[model samples]
Target: MKFLKYLLIFLAVIIVIIAILAFVAPTEVKVSRSITIDAPRETVWEYVNSLEDMHQWSPWAEKDPDMKLEYRGTEGKVGSVYSWDGDPETVGKGEQEITSIQAPSRIESELRFLTPYESKADAYVQLDETGSGSTRVTYGFESVSPRPMNVLNLFMNMDEMVGPDFEAAMSNLKKLVESGGSSGETQSEMAFR
Candidate 1:
């Protein structure tokens, strides 16, 4: 009886500590990763700007090969959207729509996850010329969790969880762009800056 009482007290103390930590945790999280690709800025931009090509290089796509996908609007234009439904615990159900783009420089989109948990985030890809025929690509996501969800940050390391996926996707993008041969757009035609 003494041991049981002690155990109950210990558990209560632990829960209280966790609740305090969660209450103090940051409500916003951002995860970003970058890679330099040996491809023209425009070529890399073309690939990133196209939703159809995104699935070819995104790490999540490789997570569930059988994941169902739906597309709407034109492929690379603003308003273009891609929706996916898959394992609730793994890929989850989400839709991403291109909200804005600056051609070969930057692309921003709204990402809405609907299952396993519902959350919305801003996803972006920025391309910058790194000289010597290389382009630096930075891909990232930023999310602001509501107050209640902020506690999840105390237990979950957002950067550690999402950073690798971004890195792998960028690596895949580099491979896909460099080995696919030129995009047939000359320097003049490919210039978007």
Candidate 2:
């Protein structure tokens, strides 16, 4: 009886602590990773901006080679959406829509995860010309977790979880662009007003 009482007290304390931690935890999580690809900004932008090209450099796509993908709207332009369904907890299911674009400089997207868990993130990629032949690309995503669920971040470091994926994707992007696999000819045609 004494042990049971002590256990109840301990559990109560843990619950209180967890509640406190959740309230104090950050509501927003952002993870970003950058790399310099040995190609012009337009060249890199052409690849990154294209929804179809994501299969070539995306870490998640690399995880599930046979994942089902669907596309809608104009590719590389705002409102363009790519949806994917895959196995494993890593890929799960999600749709990402291009929300904004700034030609060879920036692209903003909305990422909506529907399976495993439902969450939405604002994703973006920034491209900067570093030199005559090099372009620095920054890819990132930011999500705001509501209330108690945000506290899950206290135990799980979102940055550590997603950063590796971003890094891997960036590395693949670098390889694809530098190897002349991405065409520079399509850049001017894709530039939107």
Candidate 3:
């Protein structure tokens, strides 16, 4: 009975400590990665402004070649949405909707993850002209986890978890744009069906 009493006290102390830590943890998590491409900002924007074009260089698409994709609304403008269903262990399932656009400079979107977990994030791509024909592209996402769940942020490094994928995708984008391999095709012409 003494051992059981001590064990209960230990577990209670651990839970209390975690709850206190949760109050100190950050509620918002942000992850970003950037890359410079040997292409003009406008040229780079052409590929990123549309979901279909972005898929041509997406690392997740490469991970699940047979992933199902669906599109709604207009292609490159605000309000467009791209949804994908893929390997849960890799790409999972999500939909991203274009929220705003500043042609040749930035595109902001809302990302909603459906499988593995349900969550929402604000995602953005920003482009800056670096030189005569060079552009620096920054891809990032931010999400807020409320209250107790924010405690996970203490144990998880969002940047480390998502940064490598962003790096690989940026590298792929750079190669695709530099080599002129993306084709700048319309969604109907290059659907992933």
User: Which portions of model 2 show Cα errors greater than 4 Å?
Assistant: 1-15, 183-193
How much is the lDDT of residue 61 in candidate 3?
80
Once fitted onto the true fold, the runs of candidate 3 whose alpha carbons sit more than 4 angstroms away are 1-11, 185-193
lDDT of 3 by residue, 89-156 (tens): 99899999999999989999999999989999999999999876899999989999998899999999
Could you tell me the lDDT of residue 49 within candidate 2? 77
Could you give me the TM-score of model 2 versus the true structure?
Answer: 0.85
Question: On residues 104-168, what C-alpha lDDT tens digit does candidate 2 reach at each position?
Answer: 89989999999988889999889999876889999999999887888888889988988999999
Give TM-scores for every candidate, taking all chains together and pairing residue i with residue i: 0.82, 0.85, 0.88
Mind sharing the TM-score for model 1?
A: 0.82
Q: What value does the lDDT take at residue 89 in candidate 3? A: 91
Which candidate ranks first by lDDT, i.e. highest?
A: 3
- Cα lDDT of all candidates, in order? 0.84, 0.84, 0.87
- Mark the 10 consecutive residues where model 3 has the least summed lDDT: 184-193
Model 1 local distance difference test score: 0.84
Q: Say which prediction, candidate 2 or candidate 3, comes out ahead on TM-score.
A: 3
